[model samples]
Target: MDNLSRRDFLKASGFIAAAFALWRCTPREVTASVQPAPTPAPTLATPLSADDATTLTRTLRRITFGPLPNEVARARAIGLEAFILEQLNPESIPEPDILAPFDFETLEMNAGELLRVDPPGRPIGELMGATLARAVFSPRQLYEKMVVFWSDHFNIYIRKGIERALKPVDDRLVIRPHALGRFHDLLSASAHSPAMLYYLDNASSTKEKPNENYARELLELHTLGVDGGYTHQDIVEVARALTGWSITRPRRFFGGGGEFVFRPRLHDTGPKTILGQSFPAGQGVEDGEQLLDLLSHHPSTARFISTKLVRRFVADEPPEDLVTRATQTFQETDGDIAEVMRTILTSDELRASLGGKLKRPFEYLVSALRQTQAEIEPNRALFRYLTMMGQPLFHWPTPDGYPDVAAAWMGTGSLLARWNFALALAFNTIPGVRVDWDVLAGEASAPEGALDTLSDRFLGAPLPEEARSLILDFLNTLDAGFVLPALGALLLASPYFQYH
Candidate 1:
C-alpha cells in the first residue's frame, strides 16, 4: 500500500469539510439568559443510567484535560459528588510520578540560580516541557487544570528581559503553591514575585517615579474587572502604594540576586487613599498588603473572579446567576478558591454547558495526547505545534494571557494548523512522540468496528449519528492499511473532538 499523502488524507477525510460547513452555518452567539437562581444541585447517589453516565463523562471532560476510560470508570464507580470532592482537595489523591523521568534541573532553582546557567533559554524550555508533562500525564488532573487557570489569571510573559529566568521561579513558588489556596494569598504571592514585578515594570518603580503598569493590571486584569468601579487616580495611588517593591540586582561574581526586596527609602512615606479607603502615613509594605486585602475581599473582586471562573469552566458569557452564587461563595469563604470552584462545578450551569466550550490550542493538544495515550518527549518538536496553533506556553506577550473565547481561536489558519497536527500525531510523524494504534484501538480490525471503537475512546461516548455516518463513509473509502490512521486523524480533527 502506498503511503497516504496530505492531499489524499484530506480528500479521504471528508468530515473536515462537513464539520467546517456546520460550524460556519451555526450561530456562535449564546443567547441563554441567566437563571434567576440555580436548580438544586443534583444528587449523585442515584443509580447510573445511560444519561447519568453521559453526564458524568461530561463532568470529567470539563474538569480534566480529557477523560480516560479508567478515569471515566472511576468517576462512575465513586459517583459524581465524591469524584468532584476528591478532585477539589487534590492532596488526598496520590499523584503519578509524571516528572520523574524528565531531568529538568531549573524547575527547582530560584531566579538567581537560573540566571547563572550557561544557556539562558534552557530554563524556559524545561519549564514549558514540565508544564506539558504535568498536563498530559498528571493524575491530579483538576489541580493541574487550576494551575493552568491561575497561570493565565496572573500571566507573566517569559520573553521579557529577566522574566525568562524569573518565570520558572514564579511558576514553582508563586503559582503552583497557591493555585488552589485562598485568592488573597495567591495575589500576595504574585505581587512579590520577581517575574511579575519585572515583567510589569514594578521592579523599577520608585517613590520619585512610580510605575503604574503593574498597578493598572492589578486592578483591571488581575482582581477587578474593567467595570469594577475604580478611577485612574486609584491606579496612581495604588502604584504609589506599591513603590519600592523591587528585586535584588544580580551581582557579577556572587550568585545572590533576583530575590524580591522592599526598599524603605524608595517607598512613598506620605499617606494615600485607594478605593475610598484611607492609609495613614509612614506605612511601608503594609500599603501593598492592605491593598491586596482590600481588593481580594471586595464585593467586586468576588464577582469578577467568579465570573471569570464560570466563563472558563461553563460558558463563554457566564450565566449571571451562577456568577452570583459563586461570588456569594467567594465572599462567604473569604476567597477560598476550592470552595468557589466547588460552587461553580456542582451548579446546574456547568451541567447544561456540556460540549459548549471549545478547546483552545493548548487544551486541544494536551487532550489529544491524553486521550491517545501518546508517549511524548516534551521537547520543542511537541511545543512547536502549540506555537503554530497560536498558544505557545508562557509566551502570550500581554498581561491578559491567551483569550479564552472560541472566536479567538477559530481562524482559518489555526484550524488548518490543528488539522496538520492531527495528521502528524496520528501518523507518528512528530519527533519524540509516538501513538500506538494497535494498543489504542485494540482488536477492532474492520473499518466499521474500528470507527466505533475510536469514536467511543476519543469522544468518551458514541459519535452523533450524522458525524458517525460521515466518518464511516470516509473510512470505507480508504484501503485496509490506511483505515486506522485515517480514522484516527479524521476523528481527532473533527469538530466533535474540538469541543470538550
Candidate 2:
C-alpha cells in the first residue's frame, strides 16, 4: 500500500474525521487531587523520574505483552514521548521478514477440509502455539500484538466444523491486515469471510428458517457491547439483513474455492429495523454491508470498543474519564484503531491506572517468557502449557473469546496448574524450553543473593526488603536444585506477578 499522509487521509474522509481531529486539539489538564496508582513493581517499572516512569510503564505493559529486553532498553534510550509515537504509528517501521519460517501458502491451503477430520492437524491448539512463538520470538511485535487484539475483538471458536480449518487464513487475511485500520472496513471484511460465516452459523442461516445466532453475536459480542443500547428485536433484524451471505464448497474437496457468494435465493427479502434505523430491505448482500456500516458508526459501538481496549490495556475497571476520552477518539476518527490507542496511551488516566489490573493467562505467559528469556522450540510444549493454564489458543468454547478478569483465572485448579508450570519452566523440565537455574543463582551459596538475583532478573529490579526476606527464608531450607523451583513458584504465584 502506498503511504498516505495523515493530513491527506483526514481531508479525504468526512465530518467524523474532522470531529476527531478537533477532539485531538483539546488539551487535558492533570489534577493535583488524583493520587497516581503504583506502577507494576520491579519488572514493568524502573524508578526513574516519577512522571516519565509512570507513562513509560503503562505504555510498555499496555501496547506489547510486556516488553522484550531490547524493546525496554530502546524505549528508555529514546524516551517515553518518542516511544509512544512510534508504537502508535508502527507502519513507519518496515514490515519485518519474520514470517519466513511458516509456510504462508500452506496456511492458505484447503481451509474447510481440515476442520472436518478428527484430530485436526493444526487445530486451534497448534495455531495458538504458532502465535505464541511468533509473538515471543519474532521481531514483528506490533503486528503480533494487533493480531491478538483483533482476534479477541472478532473472536471465533475453532470447535465449529470447517472453522478450525479456516482460522489460519482468517488470521492472516481477515484480521491481521485490518488490525489497525478503520473498524468499518474490518467489520465488512469479517462479515464476508467464510471462517466467520461458518463459525457463527451464518452460513446455515437462510430465509425460511432464519437463524439468529450469528446476527445476535455480530451485534452483541463483536460490535456493540452487551450494554450498548439495542434491543433483541435489533438482533433479529440484523440477522435478517445478513441472510444469504455464505461461501461455496471448495473445488475437489477443499483444494481451493471461489470468492464468497451471495445467494439471494436464500436471503430474507423483508423490511427490517435495527437500532431504531429502518432498511427497506432486499434480497442481496448489501443488507450485511449496510448493517456493518451502521454498527461501525453507532455511538454504542464506539463506547463498547473503547471500553474493551481500556480493560485489555489498563485496569479491569479503567477510569471512566479515560474511557470517555478514548471513546471520543473512536467516534471522531471513524474508528481509526491506532488513533484510539494513541488517545488511551497518551492519557494521564491510563498512566495512573497501571499495576491495578491482573494479567490474563496469555499476558502472564508472554511476560514470563520475556522475563526468563526462555527459548521456544518444538512449540507444542508451550502450546500444552497454555491449555493447562486455561487460555488455549483459538479454542474459546464461545465466540465471546477469553475472559480478561482475574476471577476467571485465580481458581484453585488454575493456580496449582500455574505453579506446576512455573516449576517446570524454571527448572527446564518442560520440553523444548530451558532456563539456566545455576546461572540464575550464580555462586550465591546464601539464599539471599540467589533470591535477590532471581527477583531482579524476573521482576526488573530487586524485590522489596520484606519480599526478599520472605523468599530467602523460604529458600534457605531447600536443596540447591529445589531452591530455584521453589523461589520461582512463589514469584509466579505472587500477588505482585499476578497484577502485571
Per residue, candidate 2 scores C-alpha lDDT tens digits across 296-326 of 9999899998888877776665678888999
* lDDT (C-alpha, whole model) for all candidates: 0.83, 0.68
lDDT of 1 at 146: 94
Give me the runs in candidate 2 sitting further than 4 Å from their true place.
1-59, 94-105, 110-119, 123-125, 252-254, 281-283, 437-450, 480-486
| lDDT tens digits by residue: candidate 1, 217-282 | 999999988999999999999999999999998652466588899999999979999999999999
TM-score of each: 0.93, 0.83
Error of 1 at 436 (Å): 1.1
Worst 10 residues of 1 by lDDT: 40-49
Superposition error at 488 for model 1 (Å): 1.2
Q: Output the TM-score of candidate 1.
A: 0.93
Best by TM-score: 1
- Evaluated against the true structure, the overall lDDT of model 2 is 0.68
lDDT of 1 at 20: 58
